[model samples]
Target: MPSNDNTPRADRQELAYLPVPFPKAPPKEPRFAALRTWWQEAWEEDGVLRAMWEDVLSAPEDGFRYMAPWLRAVLMVAGVSFIVLMAKAAGEVVLEGLHQLLTAVPKVQVGGDTSSGVFAVVDQPVRTYIAQHSAGLPVAASTVYTLWLLTGITGLVLGYLSRNNGVRAMWAGWGAASVFMVWTATPATSRPIAVGLAVLAWTVLSAFAMRGLTLRRRVGRPARPARVSVKPEIHVHVPAPAPAPVVEQHPHSGCPFRD
Candidate 1:
């Protein structure tokens, strides 16, 4: 109506005023806090400390429970450190020792022909037969003996501590120890075949160790009875008041008796 108000409309006037949303930035974590969180996750998620702590608690009847709380705390930290260092050193030593042993031990050759290694086969049944038979026993008797001892001893001890766990836990312990032995033994290429046989020997030894005769005797003991308090007998006695003193009155004649 006002001459149509425009020869042409301005770009600014045509645009509508509308709010636009923006994303909020995440809160910053302090360096120390972030570091502590990382360490906590490492300890828990890796399960090293947790497993050790659980093992310690598993045998409350042992030295771990009677140990001074502070000393126990110190021992836990030091034990883990020692275990880590020992594992590293032991691995290096085993590898070097195995290399030396292999060098010293000569390979047999007949008629200009070389045969496959005595312990190179990977089939479990063949390994088992070799390990059990008198001939194969000569291949790695020491390694097999060591594995058997470790599995049996560890299974027995852990089984004793956790008697409630039954044979299953002891068997599991044996299995774990055997696997660890296989993993750690140097000259791994040759040992792979023997690992199964070693584990079988360990299983037999562990079964013998965890028969639980002593455990049964210990569990059969009667529990002590709880103490109870008894109240002392109470007696109360009240003597009757002496009979009221006797009152005697003599009657007097008339008003004169008042004198």
Candidate 2:
């Protein structure tokens, strides 16, 4: 459409010089609705979460009573291992990874075209989502969350291991979280006793956890029909006692013992 009044169409046509205003997006409604709907919806469909929370809350008996002596040793070793892995992941993901990411991102040119593309963003940062939550979550929150998660996982597994009361699995997952925290907070080089105390927490919770994953190898377990052996009913027929012969009471001979 031709301008009704314009000093020059060419001047108006020049987008750079034109008075057409860049669209001002309305201020975003930065409102968190979690409080409003969270409480209401919390009860809707949270079976999995409920179970997890219950397991966490229902952490089992602590110390030697929790398991046999043999299991305790196994659990301690496993705890050490879990702690090592946890520390390794935390360092790599939270500390080193964050530094590299922050360093690279700022160095990157603000362009996303064939002319400028992301390459060597960070040398082999992470191929998987492993520990990637660090980027989004605050460092402290992430750490606490990690702790709580480990603890919950431990409690849940221990509650089940003792059957499924041999679903007998524990010593590892139960104390693994505590030992992990101890190992993380106080390095073995500094405080070794922290590691030991983490090994046990009173007269209960001795077992941590383990892998019964070997059981998962078989999927199709056809249930066998219960064979109830019913022996033939033995009926011993005992004849009813014959009625005592009643002596006919003679109307004339009225002896009382005659009947």
Candidate 3:
């Protein structure tokens, strides 16, 4: 029999001579060439497209979070203004219709057999005057409506222009004017309702205007320094020196020696 060491060495040589299987290179990563092509086509050379792309790429991590409050305020104002203006216009139409109805009623003779007593004498002329002058009702209403519409349009433009200061002032003025017009036109019976609406609208408009002014003032003011966080210092404890080793002395000899 061959020697064991020689047999093992021969086996090792045979193993080394056998061909080794190398791993195949991983299949090239699934290409996204199609997606890249699509993106290229979608993002052409248009300025608007380029701007949109840049905005998307450069947007802050929070994605316009800072503008959320201002955006909400703007929407709120717009909604309220739309509702109020619609209501005012509707009221004007209703009043105009009532005036027309009153004008159509036949005139009653006074201090005569056909007269309906004192009411005919007292109320007839008042009703007649109101009917005739009722034509002027639309005129006043139109004046106020036009002025408010213009004021609103101006305010909207100013806001878009970032002239919040001017917008605020305009809101204040328009609000006051609306209140005055409501007071001047509405009858005693309807005065309370009209006044209440006017006051409410003015209050809201003034409040928002003041808030805007405050915001502007704060913007003009310098920003305060950010506060830094301070960490508590850690103290490491060191063991006190081990008490001096106790000394032992022979009873007779007083010489001290460490045990």
Best by lDDT: 3
Candidate 2 deviant stretches above 4 angstroms = 1-143, 146-162, 165-171, 187-190, 207-259
Per-residue lDDT of 86 in model 3: 100
Between candidates 1 and 3, the TM-score winner: 3
Q: Give the TM-score (vs. native) of candidate 2.
A: 0.22
Task: Pick out the ten consecutive residues of candidate 1 with the lowest summed lDDT.
Answer: 106-115
> What is the lDDT, from 0 to 100, of the residue 206 in candidate 3?
57
List the candidates ranked by lDDT, beginning with the highest.
3, 1, 2
Score candidate 2 by lDDT.
0.49
Candidate-wise lDDT, in order: 0.56, 0.49, 0.57
**Residue 120 of model 2, lDDT score:** 16
Worst 10 residues of 3 by lDDT: 106-115
Which predicted model would earn the best TM-score?
Answer: 3
lDDT for predicted candidate 1 compared with the true structure = 0.56
Q: How does each model score on TM-score?
A: 0.23, 0.22, 0.27
How many backbone clashes does every candidate have?
0, 26, 0
